[model samples]
Target: PFRFSALTRSCVVIPCTFQYEEDIPLTRGIWSKKTGGIVFHNGQSNVIDHFKGRTKILGDLNEGNCSLEIDDIKPFDNGPFCFHAEKGHDKYRFNNSCVFIVMKSPEKPVMTPVPAEVDAGSTITVSCSVAHTCPSHPPVFSWSVPDLSSEISHTLTSPGIWETKSTITFMVAAGDGVRSLTCTAIFWRDKQQAGTVKLNVK
Candidate 1:
Protein backbone atom coordinates (compact mmCIF):
# COMPACT_ATOMS: atom_id res chain seq x y z
CA PRO A 1 0.00 0.00 0.00
CA PHE A 2 1.02 3.67 -0.33
CA ARG A 3 1.11 6.58 2.07
CA PHE A 4 -2.59 7.44 2.23
CA SER A 5 -3.76 11.04 2.10
CA ALA A 6 -6.95 11.60 4.10
CA LEU A 7 -9.30 14.34 5.18
CA THR A 8 -9.77 15.37 8.79
CA ARG A 9 -12.87 13.86 10.44
CA SER A 10 -12.93 11.30 7.62
CA CYS A 11 -12.02 7.62 7.57
CA VAL A 12 -9.08 5.66 6.07
CA VAL A 13 -8.49 2.03 5.17
CA ILE A 14 -4.88 0.90 5.61
CA PRO A 15 -4.46 -1.96 3.19
CA CYS A 16 -2.52 -4.62 5.10
CA THR A 17 -1.39 -7.50 2.95
CA PHE A 18 1.15 -10.05 4.14
CA GLN A 19 2.30 -13.59 3.48
CA TYR A 20 2.38 -16.30 6.15
CA GLU A 21 2.55 -20.07 6.37
CA GLU A 22 0.16 -20.49 9.25
CA ASP A 23 -2.13 -23.46 8.80
CA ILE A 24 -4.55 -22.30 11.46
CA PRO A 25 -7.99 -21.23 10.32
CA LEU A 26 -8.11 -18.01 12.33
CA THR A 27 -5.71 -15.17 13.04
CA ARG A 28 -5.48 -12.28 15.41
CA GLY A 29 -4.92 -8.83 13.92
CA ILE A 30 -2.85 -6.05 15.42
CA TRP A 31 -2.19 -2.42 14.53
CA SER A 32 0.66 -0.39 15.92
CA LYS A 33 2.60 2.76 15.33
CA LYS A 34 6.00 2.89 13.63
CA THR A 35 7.56 3.39 17.07
CA GLY A 36 6.63 -0.14 18.25
CA GLY A 37 3.51 0.52 20.31
CA ILE A 38 0.36 -1.55 20.09
CA VAL A 39 -2.64 0.59 19.19
CA PHE A 40 -5.07 -2.24 18.62
CA HIS A 41 -5.16 -6.04 18.84
CA ASN A 42 -7.86 -8.68 18.80
CA GLY A 43 -6.86 -9.94 22.22
CA GLN A 44 -7.56 -6.65 23.97
CA SER A 45 -7.71 -3.10 22.68
CA ASN A 46 -6.19 -0.49 24.96
CA VAL A 47 -5.58 2.50 22.74
CA ILE A 48 -5.50 6.25 23.14
CA ASP A 49 -8.69 8.22 23.60
CA HIS A 50 -8.87 9.09 19.95
CA PHE A 51 -8.52 5.50 18.75
CA LYS A 52 -10.72 3.71 21.26
CA GLY A 53 -13.50 1.87 19.48
CA ARG A 54 -12.58 3.70 16.28
CA THR A 55 -10.48 0.98 14.73
CA LYS A 56 -11.30 -2.53 13.55
CA ILE A 57 -10.35 -5.26 11.12
CA LEU A 58 -12.30 -4.69 7.94
CA GLY A 59 -10.87 -7.64 6.08
CA ASP A 60 -10.80 -11.37 6.53
CA LEU A 61 -7.56 -12.49 8.14
CA ASN A 62 -7.88 -16.05 6.96
CA GLU A 63 -8.19 -14.76 3.41
CA GLY A 64 -4.95 -12.77 3.85
CA ASN A 65 -6.65 -9.38 3.75
CA CYS A 66 -5.62 -7.73 7.02
CA SER A 67 -6.79 -4.28 6.01
CA LEU A 68 -7.57 -1.98 8.93
CA GLU A 69 -10.37 0.57 9.01
CA ILE A 70 -10.17 3.71 11.12
CA ASP A 71 -13.22 5.85 11.56
CA ASP A 72 -13.75 9.48 12.54
CA ILE A 73 -10.09 10.18 11.94
CA LYS A 74 -8.52 13.08 13.81
CA PRO A 75 -5.10 14.76 13.92
CA PHE A 76 -4.14 12.62 16.89
CA ASP A 77 -4.85 9.51 14.82
CA ASN A 78 -2.24 10.43 12.21
CA GLY A 79 0.64 8.05 11.99
CA PRO A 80 2.65 5.42 10.10
CA PHE A 81 0.37 2.52 10.95
CA CYS A 82 1.63 -1.04 10.90
CA PHE A 83 -0.05 -4.45 11.01
CA HIS A 84 0.72 -7.77 12.65
CA ALA A 85 -1.02 -11.10 12.29
CA GLU A 86 -0.84 -14.23 14.41
CA LYS A 87 -2.43 -17.63 14.41
CA GLY A 88 -2.23 -20.47 16.97
CA HIS A 89 1.46 -21.31 16.47
CA ASP A 90 2.47 -18.86 13.73
CA LYS A 91 3.02 -15.14 13.87
CA TYR A 92 4.50 -12.46 11.64
CA ARG A 93 4.68 -8.71 11.95
CA PHE A 94 4.80 -6.35 8.99
CA ASN A 95 7.78 -4.20 9.82
CA ASN A 96 8.08 -2.69 6.37
CA SER A 97 4.53 -3.25 5.21
CA CYS A 98 3.21 -0.13 6.89
CA VAL A 99 1.23 2.86 5.63
CA PHE A 100 1.42 6.51 6.62
CA ILE A 101 -1.55 8.85 6.71
CA VAL A 102 -1.33 12.35 5.28
CA MET A 103 -4.11 14.67 6.42
CA LYS A 104 -5.56 16.77 3.62
CA SER A 105 -8.21 19.45 3.25
CA PRO A 106 -11.39 19.13 1.22
CA GLU A 107 -11.65 19.89 -2.49
CA LYS A 108 -14.40 20.45 -5.01
CA PRO A 109 -15.70 17.78 -7.40
CA VAL A 110 -14.56 17.76 -11.05
CA MET A 111 -17.07 17.93 -13.86
CA THR A 112 -15.87 16.64 -17.21
CA PRO A 113 -16.61 18.58 -20.40
CA VAL A 114 -16.21 21.86 -18.57
CA PRO A 115 -18.91 24.37 -19.44
CA ALA A 116 -20.99 21.33 -20.26
CA GLU A 117 -22.46 21.63 -23.74
CA VAL A 118 -25.72 19.86 -24.45
CA ASP A 119 -28.12 19.45 -27.36
CA ALA A 120 -31.65 20.53 -26.68
CA GLY A 121 -33.32 17.46 -28.12
CA SER A 122 -30.53 14.92 -28.23
CA THR A 123 -29.00 12.44 -25.81
CA ILE A 124 -25.80 13.26 -23.99
CA THR A 125 -23.69 11.74 -21.23
CA VAL A 126 -21.80 13.67 -18.60
CA SER A 127 -19.79 12.64 -15.57
CA CYS A 128 -18.57 14.04 -12.27
CA SER A 129 -15.86 12.45 -10.14
CA VAL A 130 -13.89 12.94 -6.96
CA ALA A 131 -11.17 11.25 -4.93
CA HIS A 132 -11.14 10.16 -1.30
CA THR A 133 -9.13 7.85 0.96
CA CYS A 134 -11.96 5.98 2.61
CA PRO A 135 -13.27 3.03 0.65
CA SER A 136 -15.17 1.38 3.48
CA HIS A 137 -17.40 4.47 3.59
CA PRO A 138 -17.50 6.04 0.18
CA PRO A 139 -18.74 9.52 -0.52
CA VAL A 140 -22.32 9.80 -1.80
CA PHE A 141 -22.87 11.68 -5.05
CA SER A 142 -25.86 13.76 -6.17
CA TRP A 143 -26.64 15.66 -9.34
CA SER A 144 -28.67 18.79 -9.98
CA VAL A 145 -30.36 17.51 -13.11
CA PRO A 146 -33.54 16.03 -11.67
CA ASP A 147 -34.75 14.52 -14.92
CA LEU A 148 -31.51 12.62 -15.52
CA SER A 149 -30.69 9.50 -13.53
CA SER A 150 -27.05 8.93 -12.54
CA GLU A 151 -25.06 5.74 -12.44
CA ILE A 152 -22.19 5.72 -9.98
CA SER A 153 -19.16 3.46 -9.77
CA HIS A 154 -16.24 3.21 -7.36
CA THR A 155 -12.71 2.16 -8.20
CA LEU A 156 -9.51 1.79 -6.22
CA THR A 157 -7.42 3.47 -8.88
CA SER A 158 -4.30 3.21 -6.71
CA PRO A 159 -3.04 1.93 -3.38
CA GLY A 160 -4.68 4.67 -1.37
CA ILE A 161 -6.76 6.58 -3.87
CA TRP A 162 -10.46 5.80 -4.35
CA GLU A 163 -12.52 7.57 -6.97
CA THR A 164 -16.31 8.04 -6.98
CA LYS A 165 -17.92 8.87 -10.29
CA SER A 166 -21.44 9.64 -11.41
CA THR A 167 -22.48 9.18 -15.03
CA ILE A 168 -25.73 10.76 -16.21
CA THR A 169 -27.59 10.32 -19.47
CA PHE A 170 -29.89 13.16 -20.35
CA MET A 171 -32.67 13.41 -22.91
CA VAL A 172 -32.43 17.09 -23.59
CA ALA A 173 -35.79 18.80 -23.83
CA ALA A 174 -36.93 22.28 -24.87
CA GLY A 175 -35.76 23.80 -21.61
CA ASP A 176 -34.17 27.17 -21.03
CA GLY A 177 -31.06 28.31 -22.91
CA VAL A 178 -28.67 27.91 -19.93
CA ARG A 179 -28.92 26.43 -16.46
CA SER A 180 -26.82 25.28 -13.57
CA LEU A 181 -25.62 21.69 -13.37
CA THR A 182 -24.62 21.01 -9.79
CA CYS A 183 -22.87 17.96 -8.39
CA THR A 184 -22.23 17.31 -4.75
CA ALA A 185 -20.11 14.77 -2.86
CA ILE A 186 -21.78 14.04 0.42
CA PHE A 187 -19.60 12.54 3.13
CA TRP A 188 -20.49 11.13 6.50
CA ARG A 189 -21.46 13.42 9.41
CA ASP A 190 -23.38 15.68 7.08
CA LYS A 191 -20.22 17.05 5.43
CA GLN A 192 -20.64 17.92 1.78
CA GLN A 193 -18.74 19.57 -1.09
CA ALA A 194 -20.36 20.79 -4.28
CA GLY A 195 -19.36 21.95 -7.76
CA THR A 196 -21.73 23.71 -10.11
CA VAL A 197 -21.33 24.52 -13.77
CA LYS A 198 -23.59 26.67 -15.91
CA LEU A 199 -24.17 25.20 -19.34
CA ASN A 200 -25.94 26.22 -22.51
CA VAL A 201 -28.21 23.90 -24.50
CA LYS A 202 -27.74 24.15 -28.22
Candidate 2:
Protein backbone atom coordinates (compact mmCIF):
# COMPACT_ATOMS: atom_id res chain seq x y z
CA PRO A 1 0.00 0.00 0.00
CA PHE A 2 1.23 3.53 -0.82
CA ARG A 3 -0.08 7.09 -0.58
CA PHE A 4 0.81 10.42 -2.22
CA SER A 5 0.79 13.98 -0.96
CA ALA A 6 -1.28 16.69 -2.64
CA LEU A 7 -1.23 20.46 -2.35
CA THR A 8 -4.10 22.45 -0.98
CA ARG A 9 -6.86 22.90 -3.55
CA SER A 10 -5.21 20.19 -5.67
CA CYS A 11 -5.91 16.55 -6.49
CA VAL A 12 -3.92 13.30 -6.39
CA VAL A 13 -4.62 9.68 -7.41
CA ILE A 14 -3.07 7.29 -4.92
CA PRO A 15 -2.07 3.89 -6.27
CA CYS A 16 -3.02 0.82 -4.28
CA THR A 17 -2.46 -2.93 -4.65
CA PHE A 18 -2.25 -6.00 -2.46
CA GLN A 19 -0.55 -9.41 -2.53
CA TYR A 20 -1.16 -12.69 -0.70
CA GLU A 21 -0.42 -16.43 -0.95
CA GLU A 22 -4.04 -17.31 -1.73
CA ASP A 23 -7.34 -15.55 -2.29
CA ILE A 24 -9.06 -15.07 1.03
CA PRO A 25 -12.55 -14.04 1.99
CA LEU A 26 -11.95 -10.33 1.71
CA THR A 27 -14.73 -8.49 3.47
CA ARG A 28 -13.90 -4.78 3.38
CA GLY A 29 -11.10 -2.35 2.70
CA ILE A 30 -10.60 0.53 5.11
CA TRP A 31 -8.77 3.83 4.69
CA SER A 32 -8.04 5.82 7.82
CA LYS A 33 -6.48 9.20 8.64
CA LYS A 34 -4.16 9.34 11.58
CA THR A 35 -4.85 12.53 13.52
CA GLY A 36 -3.38 13.02 16.94
CA GLY A 37 -4.09 9.70 18.68
CA ILE A 38 -7.34 9.03 16.82
CA VAL A 39 -8.22 7.24 13.58
CA PHE A 40 -10.85 8.33 11.08
CA HIS A 41 -12.17 5.61 8.83
CA ASN A 42 -15.14 4.76 6.64
CA GLY A 43 -17.00 1.91 8.28
CA GLN A 44 -20.55 0.58 8.02
CA SER A 45 -21.12 2.76 4.98
CA ASN A 46 -20.40 5.91 6.95
CA VAL A 47 -17.47 8.29 7.03
CA ILE A 48 -16.03 10.08 10.00
CA ASP A 49 -17.37 13.62 10.34
CA HIS A 50 -13.94 15.16 9.87
CA PHE A 51 -13.34 13.30 6.63
CA LYS A 52 -16.91 13.07 5.40
CA GLY A 53 -17.54 14.19 1.83
CA ARG A 54 -13.77 14.73 1.36
CA THR A 55 -12.58 11.15 0.91
CA LYS A 56 -13.68 8.87 -1.93
CA ILE A 57 -12.55 5.40 -2.95
CA LEU A 58 -11.55 5.47 -6.58
CA GLY A 59 -11.57 2.49 -8.97
CA ASP A 60 -13.28 -0.85 -8.35
CA LEU A 61 -12.91 -2.76 -5.12
CA ASN A 62 -13.57 -6.09 -6.84
CA GLU A 63 -10.54 -5.32 -8.98
CA GLY A 64 -8.50 -4.40 -5.91
CA ASN A 65 -8.37 -0.69 -6.79
CA CYS A 66 -8.16 0.46 -3.21
CA SER A 67 -6.86 3.78 -4.41
CA LEU A 68 -8.35 6.90 -2.82
CA GLU A 69 -9.14 10.28 -4.34
CA ILE A 70 -8.99 13.43 -2.23
CA ASP A 71 -9.85 16.83 -3.67
CA ASP A 72 -9.59 20.47 -2.50
CA ILE A 73 -6.65 19.43 -0.35
CA LYS A 74 -5.70 21.08 2.96
CA PRO A 75 -2.55 21.21 5.07
CA PHE A 76 -4.29 19.60 8.00
CA ASP A 77 -4.92 16.43 5.96
CA ASN A 78 -1.16 15.90 5.49
CA GLY A 79 -0.18 12.67 7.18
CA PRO A 80 0.92 9.04 7.31
CA PHE A 81 -2.31 7.19 6.52
CA CYS A 82 -3.10 3.52 7.01
CA PHE A 83 -4.88 1.29 4.48
CA HIS A 84 -6.14 -2.05 5.64
CA ALA A 85 -8.10 -5.01 4.34
CA GLU A 86 -10.09 -7.61 6.21
CA LYS A 87 -10.45 -11.29 5.34
CA GLY A 88 -12.82 -13.36 7.45
CA HIS A 89 -11.33 -13.46 10.96
CA ASP A 90 -7.97 -12.15 9.81
CA LYS A 91 -6.80 -8.70 8.68
CA TYR A 92 -3.92 -7.26 6.71
CA ARG A 93 -2.65 -3.70 6.86
CA PHE A 94 -0.31 -1.38 4.99
CA ASN A 95 0.96 2.11 5.73
CA ASN A 96 0.64 4.45 2.79
CA SER A 97 1.16 8.20 3.12
CA CYS A 98 1.44 11.61 1.50
CA VAL A 99 1.86 15.09 2.98
CA PHE A 100 -0.22 18.06 1.80
CA ILE A 101 1.06 21.59 2.43
CA VAL A 102 -1.12 24.66 2.05
CA MET A 103 0.02 27.87 0.36
CA LYS A 104 -2.54 30.46 -0.69
CA SER A 105 -2.35 33.60 -2.84
CA PRO A 106 0.07 36.03 -1.28
CA GLU A 107 -1.09 39.57 -0.76
CA LYS A 108 2.48 40.80 -0.23
CA PRO A 109 5.98 39.33 0.05
CA VAL A 110 8.18 39.46 3.09
CA MET A 111 11.28 41.68 3.09
CA THR A 112 14.17 40.93 5.39
CA PRO A 113 17.37 42.95 5.61
CA VAL A 114 20.39 40.90 4.60
CA PRO A 115 21.77 41.20 8.11
CA ALA A 116 18.35 41.28 9.79
CA GLU A 117 19.07 44.85 10.94
CA VAL A 118 20.26 47.77 8.89
CA ASP A 119 20.59 51.54 8.75
CA ALA A 120 18.81 53.93 6.41
CA GLY A 121 20.09 54.12 2.77
CA SER A 122 21.92 50.83 3.27
CA THR A 123 22.02 48.35 0.38
CA ILE A 124 19.72 45.42 1.12
CA THR A 125 18.26 42.62 -0.94
CA VAL A 126 14.64 41.66 -0.36
CA SER A 127 13.72 38.08 -1.33
CA CYS A 128 10.55 36.07 -1.84
CA SER A 129 9.63 32.43 -2.50
CA VAL A 130 6.80 29.87 -2.64
CA ALA A 131 6.45 26.46 -1.00
CA HIS A 132 6.91 23.25 -3.03
CA THR A 133 3.74 21.29 -3.67
CA CYS A 134 4.45 18.42 -6.07
CA PRO A 135 6.77 17.24 -8.81
CA SER A 136 4.40 18.23 -11.61
CA HIS A 137 3.66 21.74 -10.33
CA PRO A 138 6.76 23.77 -9.55
CA PRO A 139 6.89 27.09 -7.70
CA VAL A 140 7.45 30.52 -9.30
CA PHE A 141 8.24 34.00 -7.97
CA SER A 142 6.85 37.52 -8.38
CA TRP A 143 6.96 40.95 -6.71
CA SER A 144 4.90 44.08 -6.05
CA VAL A 145 6.70 47.38 -5.83
CA PRO A 146 5.37 50.83 -4.95
CA ASP A 147 7.15 52.60 -7.81
CA LEU A 148 5.27 50.41 -10.30
CA SER A 149 1.91 51.86 -9.18
CA SER A 150 -0.66 49.17 -10.06
CA GLU A 151 1.72 46.97 -12.03
CA ILE A 152 3.62 43.98 -10.59
CA SER A 153 7.13 42.94 -11.67
CA HIS A 154 7.73 39.25 -12.04
CA THR A 155 10.98 37.26 -12.30
CA LEU A 156 10.05 33.70 -13.17
CA THR A 157 12.49 30.78 -12.83
CA SER A 158 12.51 27.06 -13.44
CA PRO A 159 11.85 24.66 -10.60
CA GLY A 160 14.96 23.77 -8.63
CA ILE A 161 14.14 20.10 -8.36
CA TRP A 162 17.57 19.05 -7.09
CA GLU A 163 18.62 22.24 -5.30
CA THR A 164 17.42 23.54 -1.94
CA LYS A 165 17.71 27.22 -2.88
CA SER A 166 14.76 28.82 -4.71
CA THR A 167 14.37 32.56 -4.36
CA ILE A 168 14.00 35.93 -6.09
CA THR A 169 15.96 39.05 -5.26
CA PHE A 170 15.39 42.80 -5.16
CA MET A 171 17.58 45.69 -4.03
CA VAL A 172 15.74 48.35 -2.12
CA ALA A 173 16.33 51.29 0.23
CA ALA A 174 16.62 50.43 3.87
CA GLY A 175 14.33 53.31 4.80
CA ASP A 176 11.45 52.08 2.70
CA GLY A 177 8.24 51.76 4.66
CA VAL A 178 5.05 49.76 4.20
CA ARG A 179 6.27 48.07 1.01
CA SER A 180 4.37 45.08 -0.36
CA LEU A 181 6.24 42.03 -1.69
CA THR A 182 4.85 38.79 -3.11
CA CYS A 183 5.96 35.30 -4.20
CA THR A 184 3.65 33.34 -6.49
CA ALA A 185 3.65 29.85 -8.05
CA ILE A 186 1.28 28.49 -10.69
CA PHE A 187 0.44 25.05 -12.08
CA TRP A 188 -2.25 22.67 -13.44
CA ARG A 189 -2.87 21.86 -17.07
CA ASP A 190 -5.56 24.53 -17.07
CA LYS A 191 -3.18 26.99 -15.33
CA GLN A 192 -6.07 28.25 -13.24
CA GLN A 193 -4.78 28.50 -9.66
CA ALA A 194 -1.63 29.41 -7.70
CA GLY A 195 -0.05 29.86 -4.26
CA THR A 196 1.44 33.07 -2.87
CA VAL A 197 3.65 34.37 -0.08
CA LYS A 198 3.08 37.94 1.02
CA LEU A 199 4.97 40.31 3.31
CA ASN A 200 4.68 43.85 4.70
CA VAL A 201 7.86 45.88 5.02
CA LYS A 202 8.33 48.05 8.04
Off by over 4 Å in 2: 1-3, 35-46, 95-202
**Per-prediction TM-score to the true structure, in the order listed:** 0.83, 0.43
Give candidate 2's TM-score.
0.43
lDDT of 1 by residue, 1-202 (tens): 3577777788878777766656767558778887766767775545755577778888788877788888888876667787877666666776567777888776578988743567777776778888887887788888776645668899998876799898887776777688777889887545689988877877
With a 3 Å backbone cut-off (N, CA, C), the pairs that clash in candidate 1 are none
Candidate 2 per-residue C-alpha lDDT over 1-202 given as tens digits, one digit per residue, 9 for 90 to 100: 2334355655444556655445554676666655432222446245655566666666555566676655555566655556676676677765443223334432222333345334444344444433332333343333443222222233323321111123443445465454434433343222332233333334
Q: TM-score winner among the candidates?
A: 1
User: What CA RMSD would you report for each candidate?
Assistant: 2.8, 10.5
The best candidate in terms of lDDT: 1
- Give the range of the ten consecutive residues with the poorest summed lDDT in model 1: 42-51
The global C-alpha lDDT for each of the candidates, from Candidate 1 onward, is 0.76, 0.45
Candidate 2 local Cα displacement, residue 177, angstroms: 39
Q: How far is candidate 1 from the true structure (C-alpha RMSD, Å)?
A: 2.8
